[model samples]
Target: MQADSDPVTSGMIRRLLRLVLGSKGYDLPFKSDTDRNFLLLLVALMSFLAVLACAGTLTLHAMTQRWSSGLENKITIEVKAETPNGEILSPESVKLDTEKIAGMLEGNLAIKSYQVMNEVEIKKLVSPWIGEDFSFDEIPMPGLIAVELSAATPETLETLTQKVLSVAPSARIETHREWLQDILRFVKTLQGLAFLVAMIVVVTTITAISSGVRSRMAIYRNQVEILHLIGAPDPYIARQFQWHAVIVSLLGSVIGTAAGLAVATLIFHLSGKDETALIPEIGLNYGQIAAFIILPLLACLISGTTARFTVLRTLSQMP
Candidate 1:
């Protein structure tokens, strides 16, 4: 009971809560700063960009994970439209080539299943390029075989490559694993870049707040010196700037967050993707949405701390 009733403990708890939750009081004349609204706008803009950077990083990781899982054990065998000598093959030759590849796949125990696309399916695949209205029957199209494997091991790839070359000399084997790995590497680099951008935004925010604190201190330098002469400590003065910073940060973050969400939603809606498409949809799950709320709180915390430290450091130098 004595510990709980200690004046020092009670004072500390009140200060900590005031620092975190803020209060409606300002010792320094913050209203006199004509450019304070501009400061809020700048913070809001930076916060908006930071939100986008974080969301982009998350979305990219989700996309790459989806692509990696869906493509890892899959491979494609592309039978060329022309022979090695560059002469176009007849439909019969292409059909025979697919049959030979299918037989080879059946022989390999590693192959879980394989499907040779029919002429209609092949035409449909190329519909985006040549148009669905085109009715040409003699067009030489490269045959594609969709192959799924039980395991896409290195030995499986090597053995399959050799068998494919022996059977169809002009065919190309595209192991999705190889290309997917490259894509994952690229995505990771992009994620790193996004993280770097987020860090830059944070630094920018801190710098802006520090500059504002300095300017505010300068504006109220007379009042601050008199407060010091009357024996007011630095923390006593620090709370003034801290509470104002928290208020501005909270208001700015609210606007920034709403704008960021609107823009993200607009981009996602305009992407023209559907459930049938292989492209991963851009969205935030409940967890991601909840995580997003932390961004504003973080901004407020950073703003308050920066303002507090800047005010304390500046005030300590006053004579």
Candidate 2:
């Protein structure tokens, strides 16, 4: 019902005609729209993509929250087998450096606690790569310290770095936040891509609806011309397109959404409920479930509106 004149008033008037026509008043043979099934297939595929994209966006959003909180206010110290002056040190030196780092942590009021992982733990970490029997006595192994802080501010991190460097300049201090930052950025990029795909789905659905409307109009041109000859308003003709499009789109959307969620549920179960799964138990909440349910209904409304506008425009151009 868009117009060279007022769009709102014209839309209202067209809708009034549609209401007056009800479901029974049409001069055109509704069965003559040969592209109906094709349009439904296209709409169904687009709606499926829309649902998956939304689910991905929501899942990644949840991952961001879980991952960020994991590293909050935490840091790690890697005590390598090196001296303050960048010289390789003996295993004894590395252990002494680790002990010094631990002592520093114990004395610092800002640190809540720290654990210097034993040689057995270090050996266990390396065993998967170099074999279980690999002896650390042959090569000086790096030490690790897990530190928990009461509060980790810029000044606190700076002070901790200085203290570690004083003991062993080669020691590496990690707040464990760099990896988390990279993960968050990657997740954000994925979320953006999902949103972009959803928008593409919307545009594609509208395009499909428009194509169906025009194709039907072309196939029934003689009947439409006779209606024009009889002095029927364009709105009266447009309602036929509007309701048919709505019914077709509604059916497509329901099929697509149900299929999409079914696939999602299958994948979710395959991902396993492993408590150790990095992504957490990825499942839709009530809100997300409701959104999927609402998506098909929205498709109905959009297709109907697109059909109305396409008719008004196409009929105005016809002789």
Candidate 3:
């Protein structure tokens, strides 16, 4: 009965004191206002860098998927203007060879669809490198045919290439498989680097909190000794410092996350206005957004744990 009513009696006393003292309340003096503000700024900076790294990783991953999907199961065939007799073929002969290759591709079971590009289309493709005002009639340009395959397999590709070569000996096939592999490898490397950076930032934050706790312990050594003499336990004293660290880190992380998100939003808005911009859309799916939202709480947890451990270790070393 005494243990059951103890909590109720303490609650009533706290309420009475609150009523008499208005806003006055008891709090530990582990950190001054300046100390807290500085910690908050430090945490905010760390959080901002972390958020940027996370967002960049997500964006790069999205880009990799988009690029791979767009290029998958796609191949291009170019019919050069040359004959088997080591003589230059005329434009008319090139067109005939291109049509023959397209007809063969259309009959192939592996090809889903094929289109032979017209002279105007071929000219437009080369206009970027050669001046837009250049004429295609004076120069003999190879014809381009884009083919989409239903089943992308090595055997199917080899068969299709052999069939095209049989029809047009000068035709060459290009597949994006090698290029895509290179791009995927690069993206994976970047993601790994981003993760490493975020871990470093977390470690730095923990070290900063641990240092602050040690500094505070030295400054309040006399007060801590008195508390110990009065029979205060290490855990009870540690809670005060731990809670302070949590509050400071939480506030800073919130501010930093908000700032990072705001910058991302602005960039997305601007990028959306330009259709040709290479910047991938800055939209996070639900899972990614949830992860970002939890980052601040994670920072607080790290700070609190660091403080608790530092305080306990310091107290253990005391005589």
Question: Per-residue lDDT for 1-319 in model 2, tens only?
Answer: 1232433323443354456566343456654345766777787888788888888888788778877776777888998786667677888878888898898788789998888999898887778678887678776789899888888889999988998999887899989787888888999999999999999999988887898788888988898899888988998888778877776677778888988888877777777667656577787777787889888988888899999999999999976
Which 10 residues in a row give candidate 2 its minimum summed lDDT? 1-10
C-alpha-based local distance difference test score of model 3: 0.79
lDDT of 3 at 170: 93
For candidate 3, the TM-score is: 0.85
State the lDDT of candidate 3 residue by residue for 1-319, as single tens digits. Answer: 1221333323443344345334432135533335666688889998888887888788888888898887788999999876667677788889989998888877678889888898788887888678678666677788899989997889988898898899988999989889789879988999999999999999999999999889888888888888777888998778767777776787789888888776765665777788756555656666886788788999989998999999999999876
Q: Deviation in angstroms for 93 in model 3?
A: 1.8
Roughly what TM-score does model 2 have, to 2 decimal places? 0.79
Each candidate structure's TM-score, on Cα atoms with residue i matched to residue i, is: 0.82, 0.79, 0.85
Off by over 4 Å in 1: 1-24, 31-33, 132-137, 177-193, 273-279
Q: Extract clashing residue pairs from model 2.
A: none
- Error at 195, model 3, angstroms: 1.9
lDDT of 2: 0.80
**Residue runs of model 2 more than 4 Å from their true location after superposition:** 1-27, 84-92, 107-109, 120-124, 228-232, 273-281
Q: Where does candidate 3 have its weakest 10-residue lDDT segment?
A: 1-10
Candidate 3 local Cα displacement, residue 122, angstroms: 2.6
Q: Clashes per prediction?
A: 0, 0, 0
